[model samples]
Target: MENANRGYERLFGDDGLTVGATFPLTSARTTRPNVGRELALTERLEALGFDGLWARDVPTDWPKFDDTGQTFDPWTWLSRVAARTDDVALGTASVVLTLRHPLHVAKQAASLDHLSEGRLVLGVASGDRPPEYEAFGVAEDERGAAFRESVEVLRAAWRDAHPEVETRWGTLDGTLDVVPKPTAGDLPLLVTGNSRQSREWIAAHGDGWLFYHLPEDALRSYLDDWNERTAAPFVTTCTVDLAGDPEADPEHVNQGFRAGAAWFRDYFRELDAWGVDHVIVGVRGDDRERAYERVAERVLDRL
Candidate 1:
């Protein structure tokens, strides 16, 4: 927490609300989206003064799940996003830590952090797909322990030189080290969901918490509890399908709501007042460019 990097500051350095958008802005229904259009939209968002651009980690496509989250590997996709935009915080909505090797994750993350000039903010999760876990040869039940160990290993690799470490993944002796430490000497890691760990544990170990969209009253209660537990920032994602009418009422959608610009402006105002640090907004309508512009003009600017 001492060496909080540029990305962290971009998103949570201040004590108010900042807005970001999730990828696949070009297409929401399919796993693969038009990459060129996505990048173009990304640059536009940054130019419009959005604080962050987040990438999702969907290593393998699951048919039952409706959304695949940009379809590209988070690291490589984020690297591309980093190259396209300057100053926008680049983040992983989360990397599936339980399915990957911690050392590899450490190297990839550090490398990305440096290449992005310290703009990488990592949101890591213990994956939920049972079949994917089987495919990766990781035990489903052990993911919680794996998730905890991964966190410890990541911290050790970034903070210490050739730090001796042992966990379910492997053992690292003092002889070897993960090269290219993060640009600011450390990366801000926000634990996604609970990741099968206790809230107390996450509050103690993580730089922040990344949560899914919740109803207003539920979110307020959760935020109050989080405030009581720790001072770490809280980040949440909300999908939006902006209605054509400016004064439309909010209708519940998957993980978010469908509403008009007027309603969203008031909603974000409430979130800011409730102490939510950042909101990663996912626009869901067909005309994403229009949705982006509307959010910036009507929702973000109003706040």
Candidate 2:
């Protein structure tokens, strides 16, 4: 918990409200690797006073789902973003820990955290895609245990003097330290969704929570459940397609809200009232410039 505190302090500071925007990995209809454009967008968001930038982890191909994420590796993109930007915290909405070896994740996360000068927040999950699990040679039913053990391994690897971690996934010799040490000496690990883990486990382990889109009433219920179980704050990411028109009708996307600036203000206000610490907005749809400007002018001011 001390390490968790260090990680939390580096990212959240004292505001208790860190507004951020999700990095757009894929264009509307293109598969072109656009880290440059995404970096430009991130710079714009940073100048516009957003607190952090969140990346998504989509490692495998799953066409039927039509993933909005575009399936780019999160850590690679974040490393690029970290080098490009100075102030904004670099983060992943949720890295699929179950599919990856913990040592690799720990090393990469620690390196990014060090490179970014303590601005990395790692959100991890068990993952839901059966195909992804199959591709990774991981059984669907075993992901829960895999996820738990992975977290344990990562933590053990990053400890003050590193400890031996032996699990079904792998084994670590005594005290195998993962470098570079985090700027705050520990990487913040936020859990996404339930990740097939119990509330008590989450409450005791996770530094924070990453939840997806939910209605206000439902969000309130979910947050209440989480808060009651764990006193730590929760962070949620949702997509938004801001319109030029102030009276734009609300459109729905997967785990996102598409509306005008006015609507966004109201939505964020509701989230603030609910004690949500951070909201990462994924801006999609047309007129990216107008959306960014509108959010900067109307939405960022309120946050």
TM-scores of the models, in the order given: 0.97, 0.91
Q: Pick the candidate with the highest lDDT.
A: 1
Q: What range of 10 consecutive residues in model 1 has the weakest lDDT sum? A: 23-32
Tell me the TM-score of model 2.
0.91
Please tell me which predicted candidate would have the highest TM-score against the true structure.
1
Query: What lDDT tens digits, residue by residue, belong to model 1 across residues 1-303?
Result: 777888999999887799998887787777579888888998899988899988888888888876677888888898888888889999998999998898999999999998899899999999877789999999899999999999999999998999899998889889898998888887888999999999999999999999999988889998999989999999998987788898999999988989998898888888988989999988876778888888898888877
Q: What C-alpha lDDT, on a 0 to 100 scale, does residue 137 get in candidate 2? A: 91
Model 2 residue 254 CA deviation in Å: 3.5
Clashes of 1: 0
Off by more than 4 A, model 1: none
How well is each residue in 126-159 modelled by candidate 2, as lDDT tens digits? 9878788878899999899999999998888777
Model 2: colliding residue pairs: none
